[model samples]
Target: MRYRHLAAASLLALPLVAFAQTAPAPAPAPAAPPAPADVPLIARTQATVPQPVLGPVDQALRVTPATNAKGGKIHMLPATLETTQWGWFDNAQPPVLTVKSGDSIALETMMHAHNQVVPGTTIEQIKKTRTDYPGRGPHSLTGPIFIDGAEPGDVLKVTLNKIVPRSYATNFNVPGMFGEFPKEFPDGQVKYFYLDLVKMETEFLPGVFIPVKPFPGTLGVARAEPGRYSSVPPGKYAGNLDINEFTEGASIYIPVFVKGALLWTGDSHAGQGNGEINLTAMESAFRELNVTVEVIKGQKLEWPRIETKTHWITIGYDRDLNIAYDLLQKETVKYLVETKKAPDEAAATKLMVTNWDCRISEVVNVVKGTYCMTAKTAGKPVAKLPTAETATAFVTVGTDADLNKAMDTASMAMINLLVEKKGLTRLDSYGLVSAAGDCRVGPPAGATKTVVCQTPKSLWRTKTASK
Candidate 1:
């Protein structure tokens, strides 16, 4: 959500201590020197758009890809202050690096709210940075990379090859910038964590270990619009999506907007729950993140979609959960219909209802998100929502915002309930709810919609001893 424009002096009055940072030290040397003015920045160029081979309209517009134009060149873009854009995405921003389609980039990304939150950084410093650049997102995105021959009506296929996270991470909950349960936690709290790469897991809370699954929290091409846009809320351009599914080996197809399809990424995370209920995940930096970019012509898409080895994920975003869910469903139907897998919309809807699992992406991103996952091959459907159990404890908590926010509150409340009633650790509860808890929307009451999530009764069957 776009926050109200605040005068520079107002930042001092706001609380920052509770929502600040401290972390690993960066070397004194300049992260990376900027390209010299005399040096040519464009690594590759295509004077004309490639001719297309017509094909069926599948999930990513089934058009054949242009010949690999990389020519064995890989670009390295470091996350220096000069190369990174703090909190905004503008089509007009100059490209730090440009390359032909089908090239790979070895990129480094900073922590949340941009790279400003390093060790010894103060709350006032973070606030000052915010005031310096008003009306933008807090993420430190690292490019408006220009891809030769990219233009509107084309699809940019981005493949994530490797994502190696830095040793440390941070998570926070700010009071003024409340997440799902606005009233539940009145104060802000920030926590730092050290990750173990060899173990491939983090001891989040004493004995509670969480598997590491790092991904770029935000990545997308420039929007069709001409001016600058806040990188806070995700749109068709795919900014600030915080989708956990974008881990290594996943590919996302984005619709080209302006020519060259200005691409950028930031807001990296090591691990996150499905809802991201607290507004922050394992917000961290990446030491080594590798990605390959390709431009596909003769095909277009209305929304961005992700492809994993096992399933296709269709994403939808809106302030209203119902509307977002509807958009996700329609996108799924469109993909099925275009691919000729379903004879018509009715059949596609049936198949979607039977085979797809709808999931809440995140509710804290100002704009809420919902997505559906359909297996690549036919099989029994997988369930995600919490369900009734034969012998256990179940609890439903209610709060108000959008329908998705209600679900967020329900999720947070259930997590607390699990920790208290089942003797489970907070991390344990969070992991359990994220992977298996189900949330539902109830009829709207007055100005606020009611959302509910419950723990399965079976949770009480086991004795959880917190280490």
Candidate 2:
């Protein structure tokens, strides 16, 4: 099933999920400003209780001995200024913590804006922090946890074991920050909530409560490139995906780029919607989050893929929604072919249209995201997808800031593939690709925008002879 988006105006008017856990409703908050004409009356309030103070930066990165199923060592990572990256993913950033391939991490992740947003903290204070860190992302990512054996082209298997969050959260959107409805509400707003950890829910307004489904909003390995990259837009390395499906019981496979797969994760969220329209969710910190990392050698992945009990998710990112959708479709079809789930491109398309579910991952990020999900039982289950190089008729254009240039590069590559590999005349190759080639956008963020085009492998398969 797809995730739901929580609209800004009607916080509780939209549908919400029900959980078995229950608790007494919390008291109303102290009245602050009167609701705007468009905002709900119940939504205007401030926390009377003092927010829990988070940290004094831990001087030394430390780990204590703990047990796991694989008998792997556990590392306890605290969310101190010294431990977390302010707002960037840089391959050059040295690892603050190192672990074995199969070791588990019992870690703490901070809230948005580098754990600066808390009860009684004013919007002006947040603005000052923004000015303080001029070019960095707001997410307080906690690592560059170098796995001892990970290498380029390998896949890092991350399994979510547990996530328990702190007692409060903040949700906000800045006026000029390009949220879904920035123009409608000129004066941006910020709101807070008290999470009942025992019940796993949070109070949004007087009677409205949202379930506390916690997940790390940003998780990725170091990029192959050298420079520091903003953590706002997610790319091939899967940073700031903001996908809610990455909760407890879900596993994500990330393609490793740099040596040791320097993994970093943060941007903790108590809960979020499908699109994260207001540019934020119940942004909060985690008390204790557990994950197990393993390095799978020989296998490869062009983009990140997620797995849960019932579904397998494929992702795509691009500035254009349509191109993002196409990119998702391309990844799905490519996965189907390489995993032997579909006989060919035509069959894969049929399967997708008939059974898969597509949803928007997010819209607020600079590079928008779209993803598709197919039930685990749709076909023979694949433990992992093969490398993109295995495909005979596919070309992936690397990320570019310009969307047009990215597509053009992919188009040219496809033209050459048809001419050189399929033995078609150059003119015919161009026409054929223009008419039948499927183009999709892949990982995109900051200055990276990737486009991939794949023609049917059956195009080169020997046709049957007829009498």
Candidate 3:
């Protein structure tokens, strides 16, 4: 019986006896739940704040309305006059106003004339005489917007955001009136070369396109005296500086005067040369300016300074270039010694000799001036320094072979720090890095096969030091 059972088992173990058979297979891990479709694609976008507006005046400044048959009507806001004058005074009281840092202001002018399209005339002269002297007529002008808190010793910082010219006309040069070259030049002899603005294009050259930028030629704060001041010359209070820098994205520092810094701004120019040689730029009707004002306490400046994204310019005005240059040099030397606090005179002198970069703002203007030299500091030139909450750190984790993964992870961390920890707008944070950041990866020191990441010392230090 045992032999028969063994024989049967052996027969069952044979390959032909069992043949082949299979069971069902399992399904794939669910397909990843499809990922959320609402995730943002872009990292950031530039943001802008709404600008503020100033309407017709009240008790602070006297407001008067004047009308014209040809041009239209305008609202005039005059400053408190200590004394009254019959003619155009060289020192006119600057408009008084108030503002804070980061606020954008716009000035609008409305005026009318019989010959809507003539040029080369003062607004007062055009209105009273009522004669089309070919090139001389009253062109409506406005502003030298005075910022509040600007005083005798401090600087008034103005950041121009935008300037627009809504209307304009041309003035043909005529004999006997102002701006006539040589007395012998006949009256109305100059052809009608002036442009009457239905709208004309500004061409810098044959192929280049120049956008129209309008600003007040006479922007300045009020004088310190109790009496009415003239508007002709630019003084410590800042009037009629004729600085071309009043354009957009520029920061202008004006000497402060009086309490609340009575800032009056008007007389917007569509465009003009440095000297205003012909006594006019693209004389037009009404200009709009978007500006921001800031007051620096206890900052006494002898003259105004201007800064832009690219340049740090100093304005020195005097009777002679030598005097202006001397003043500029003195200011530059003081700035270096005081602000930078170079170790000693030799160190300061070396800095000036080795790294100083300077240039002329405009040499031919009637306002004899020399814009002294200086190079913009080599780093992010922000309007204000970064705060701890806004700062960021960039760390290097590994060699080049692993750089891509490291950067990807590091960037995610940075985003998290900005959005979750710092409570800043994601767009602003990204923009800050974009405009003022740099990254590099290269072979590590003394390591032939390894690489390290690096960034500008200033930015990196600022992030680490919270300064």
Candidate 1: stretches off by over 4 Å? 1-71, 119-134, 389-402, 405-409, 422-467
Residue-level lDDT of model 3, residues 368-445, one tens digit each, is 444533556654322321222222333322332343333333333443454464454443233222222222222112
> Using alpha carbons, what is the TM-score of model 3?
0.48
* TM-score, predicted candidate 2 vs. hidden true structure: 0.68
Evaluated with TM-score, which candidate comes out highest? 1
| Candidate 1 lDDT (Cα, 0 to 1) | 0.69
- Pairs with steric clashes in candidate 1: 385-438, 386-437, 386-438, 392-457
lDDT of each: 0.69, 0.69, 0.41
Worst 10 residues of 2 by lDDT: 14-23
Residue-pair clashes per candidate = 4, 4, 38
What lDDT would candidate 3 get against the real structure? Answer: 0.41
Ordered from best to worst lDDT, the candidate numbers read: 1, 2, 3
Q: Which stretches of candidate 3 lie over 4 Å from their true place?
A: 1-102, 110-148, 169-211, 341-366, 378-467
The worst-scoring run of ten residues by lDDT in candidate 1 lies at 12-21
Candidate 3 positional error at 185, Å: 6.9
In order of TM-score, best first, we have 1, 2, 3
lDDT of 1 by residue, 83-182 (tens): 6776677787788778778788878887755566755555445444555444556787888788988989999999998999999876655444435544
